[model samples]
Target: MSERKVLTKYYPPDFDPSAIGRTPKHLRKQGPKVITVRLMAPFPMKCTNCGEYIYRGRKFNARKQTLEEKYLNIPIYRFFIRCTRCSGEITFRTDPKNMDYECEKGAKRNFEPWRDSKSGKYNETEEETLDRLEREENAEHEQQERDKMAELEEKMHDSKREMAIADALDEIRTRNARIARNEGKDDEAALDSIHEQVDESLLQAEREDEEAARKAFMTANGERIKRIVEEEEEDPVPTAAPVSAQSKPAASISMPPPSSTSFSRVKKTKKSGNLLGIKKKPSLV
Candidate 1:
């Protein structure tokens, strides 16, 4: 059978980690003093090399060293430590300007620098004052431009309205003049058409009258010739027996004068009109 070995350690309640025994001055100046602090609360951290988070209240052996550089004329102290996981070098220091400790470069801190700057005694910075003045100047210039535009608009409104009215009136007058000219042209054209129609009608009437006169003359002559022919055919006329020169007058008187109509009765009427209003059919030929 194998036996388990046991080990034990003892300490007193008055233990102090900061207590140091007297040491030689030459040895103290040569190296930085290291300390272990208990974190009151959790702090979130990330390792640069391993990219691991180190939770707050974790123990670390850190060397404390003072830098010659200062912030706000106050000496700054630095803590040098190695990451617990990757042993990556990290450095941090107290920041008096922001009233919070800031990570110099190795890692990031979540503290906001402006938090302490907004105290009751805070004053406006030079940049902030200049930005305010520039804003005011720009606003003033814009207001002046708006005012100028408003004044110009007020003046232009009346002039534009008057010009628009005048233009409308001119357009109306021009339209009226053009319409009058067109009407006059139409009237002149109608009058010329009417005159042409009247002349045509007169010429037609003259031609018709001439044709009627010729027909009437032909009919009268034909009737007279026909009657003469019938009478000669019906009764043979005895040649007047050699009437002596002395009996000539008596023979002419004895024979009744041949019948005839007067020249006036046979004349064709000159009047032309549609007295009966009869519709005559035109010859297709």
Candidate 2:
């Protein structure tokens, strides 16, 4: 037991080191370098050999090997895993272009809804994609044309509205101008009529004044003549002296007798009032 625990080992003095054989070159260069690594499944898959389902994140001792194929100078790697139930070999490789993995054999990758939706290339052909793009372009063009037509119609309506508003404004301005002209004419005519009425009233007042003065003067002269006639009749006349033959007969001065018809009295009527400082006399009866 002590000897087994000892660190040093005994060797024969006649041991020969050159008798060991070396590995053959043909076997060394036969295949790619394969390394055993512990890894988790990247995606879920179903084993084709046994129809057994394998979920993601399952741990496996996989053989990883670098292949000659490269994408943009980056090395590609292949992984070999075995199904747990049937021990069937499953192979998958890294896809650098798509940044995913592709199953080569012995298994079928499960459908990933998120990945299919993101790629937009699931189960669709090239012709179907072209048709879909063409339909979208046509729909966008039609929409653009409809928008342009709507804009044109809106512009036309705006122009028409502006024109109508301008016409209405013009009509209103003309009407206002005509009304102003008519008002000015009416004002002038009214002033002229008022002046004429004033002048006519003045003329009528002058005629009334002249007639009143004439009637007053005639009444005064008739009264004076009647008084003189009364005085002559009341006094006796003296006898005249005899005229000599030497003096021609002096012409006898004669006066006309006063008559009632020589002057006529005027009748007066009631009047409203006097104008222009003229006073009216009271009526006798």
Predicted candidate 1: what Cα RMSD to the true structure?
A: 31.8
The weakest ten consecutive residues by lDDT in model 1 span 223-232
| lDDT score, candidate 2, position 105 | 98
Whole-model Cα lDDT of every candidate shown, in order: 0.69, 0.86
Q: Residues 80-173, candidate 1: write the lDDT tens digits.
A: 7777777888777776654656666555544435544565223555577678779999999999999999999998998999999999999999
Off by over 4 Å in 1: 1-43, 110-285
Model 2 TM-score relative to the real fold? 0.36
Model 1 CA lDDT for position 76? 83
lDDT of 2 by residue, 179-267 (tens): 78667787778678779999999999999999887677666545422333444455667788776655655465445899997788878
| Residue pairs clashing, model 1 | 43-56
